[model samples]
Target: MPRKERERGAHQREPKGRKQRKAPSEGKERLPEDKPEANQLKTEQEKEVKLKSTVVDIDSVREKEESLALLEAAEQEDGLKNKNLGVFEWLLMVFALALVLLFFPFSIWFCVKVVREHERAVIFRLGHRLQGKPKGPGLLFYLPFLDVCHKVDIRLRMLKVPLHTVVTKDLARPELSVVCYYQIENVALCSAALSSLTSVLQSVVQAAVRDVLAQHSFSHILLHRRRIGEKIKAGVDSVACRWGIRMERADIDELFLPVELQQTLATEAEAKRQQQIRVSSCNGFQ
Candidate 1:
């Protein structure tokens, strides 16, 4: 019985020890009185975050303002430089005017040009073409040292091509000389487009003649001279149009046949003449 009582006492002591451990856990639970302190700490942290964000935003705004100020300063400097350049140009104009007035008659003689009715003038000022139609037919005044003028003849012109040898489709070689009549339709293109007008026209005419004549026999070229000439003219005209030249006419000026071919043609003509004479005599006799 005594041992059983001791066992009961041991059980009662173990429960007390467990109750003591649980009591500390209850003390560790969240308390209403401590909630206000926790809330205050949270509010303080939020305020710190807001302050940091506001500081960052202020720094960005300052940087933007500084960049904008730099840009504005650069624009102001550019505007000032442009104004200075404008003033310099105006001063130069005034100085040029005074010089022209000082030597009035001499300036007129140097600056004034007379363009004939058959001519047109293209003007270049400060190395740039003047943006308009060509000037012509009267007095043309321009700045003496600052402007350059090119006077082009706008009338009809004749170009005679030198004798060029060509082979016909029948394998007969012939020497041909051509005469080309042309007029300048656009003076600006004619003057500025070609480095050597005469040479270019000469080459064009020779090429056209060779190309057109090579497609026909020698006899056909002689018999159909007009048709061949027209074909040559059309070929030259197509290329000339790009350079502002209008081909008025292209004609074969001279043609020379080989000695053997000429002799053959003469003998053939003589035979035809003899046959015609014999026929006529027979008719008379009848």
Candidate 2:
């Protein structure tokens, strides 16, 4: 009886120990399965991140395209508005034309414009420059209210430049006055391009004079006044060509030296004169 009892206890204990070992083996097998699950989760998370980045890029591109489309649409609308005329404007234009016609020969005073031979008329209709060359030297008939005319003289004109002070290469400051003669080559351009022709010409001439004079000594400028004038004319003409004006001549009207410089120059001239007199006396004695 004692041996059987011991045998039974040993069997129970053996089964318990076997169970503990089997539990550890089962856990080891489950580890591989859990590893595969973790790997799958990692791959899925990476795919999700990639998709989000792509979605963000797509959204940014779409927003940019939408803004561009809106801008284009607005520009198209503005262009259309500028190109099309309204009904009221058309009616007003027609009415003005009829009223002018109703007055007939008497209306010629207002509708018919006589441009002198040396004058050109630049017509503006509906706030836009009229196509074709300028109208001139003949009768120009148009509705008074619907059309406007600007008379431009094609004759030669003179612009007197204001006094300008400049520093010469010799460090001498001199005040200068210039006179410019210019002729209009293209009346249409002269009318359309410049607001004040005299003012523009005056400024250009002043700048040219300053620039040209600054490069030469004061004595050189005084002795070679003609050459310097030609240089200034060339500079002015180059710029004037773009505005349809031809520069005829640029002349230095006057040059005023500083009082101190003038006194110094006078003293030097006196000294030179005395030296010349002394040399002449010595020559006469020999």
Candidate 3:
């Protein structure tokens, strides 16, 4: 190699090295000016991060608030339910207490009996009749344990006697049913006098009907039914007076006979009517 060529090469290599070193130093010097932009960029990035974190925190707070609201609403609803139940229980207790208070005193202290205008109350003490005749048509009071009360109807009452097969004076057998009208004349005596009132009254009426009917013939019974009824009324009234029962009226409601007797009576009536018709025709011809 020539000496000059070696020197020239050395100069060229030194210039290249100087250029590479100068480039790195210039880059280092420029870093100071670029620091502001870098700092601005970092600040912007920090602001974005802050904004994202703030948004997340705000969402978390909103979720917490919503959950709190839901919990509060649930608590309020439970509170309302408890309050309503308390109110209902209190009302029921008050109503029941009032009922007990009102009913207990009325049941224990007062023994009130309501008698209608057409009714009379006969008071009996220990199975014996009381001194006063009978309670009025209004209200009456009686002892609960020792006294007994019997209500008597002062209005007109009707009783129907069962069918009685009676043998007439002429030996004709007929079945008879009767209706009797009676009113209570003395309320105390009527209830106190008879052990079995309705049964005894019925039996007496039946006996009176039998006794009265046995004295009359079948034809006379049919002809004078009203007279027979009057007699029955008299007999029943006489027996019923001791029981404070007065017979207002008695009537033979229905009468029945055997089929053969009915047919015979019907035939006899028809024959008599035909004979009358023929006699009238003969008189007209004459």
Q: What lDDT does each candidate get?
A: 0.82, 0.82, 0.78
Residue 216, model 3: Cα distance from true site in angstroms: 1.5
**lDDT at residue 273 of model 2 (Cα atoms):** 100
Which of the two candidates, 1 or 3, achieves a greater TM-score against the reference? 1
Candidate 3 residue-wise lDDT at 43: 100
Sum up the clashes in candidate 1. 0
Native-to-model Cα distance after best TM-score fit, residue 107 in candidate 1, in Å: 1.3
The lDDT-based order of candidates, best leading, equals: 2, 1, 3
Please rank every candidate by TM-score, starting with the best: 2, 1, 3
Ten-residue region with minimum lDDT total, candidate 1: 76-85
Q: lDDT tens string, model 3, 12-110? A: 999899999999999999999899999999999999999987775656775676566446544533332212235654565466556556787775455
Candidate 1 stretches with Cα past 4 Å from truth are: 1-98, 266-286
Could you tell me every candidate's TM-score relative to the true structure?
Answer: 0.61, 0.63, 0.55
Candidate 1: deviation at residue 96, Å? 4.1
Deviation of model 1 at 136, angstroms? 1.0
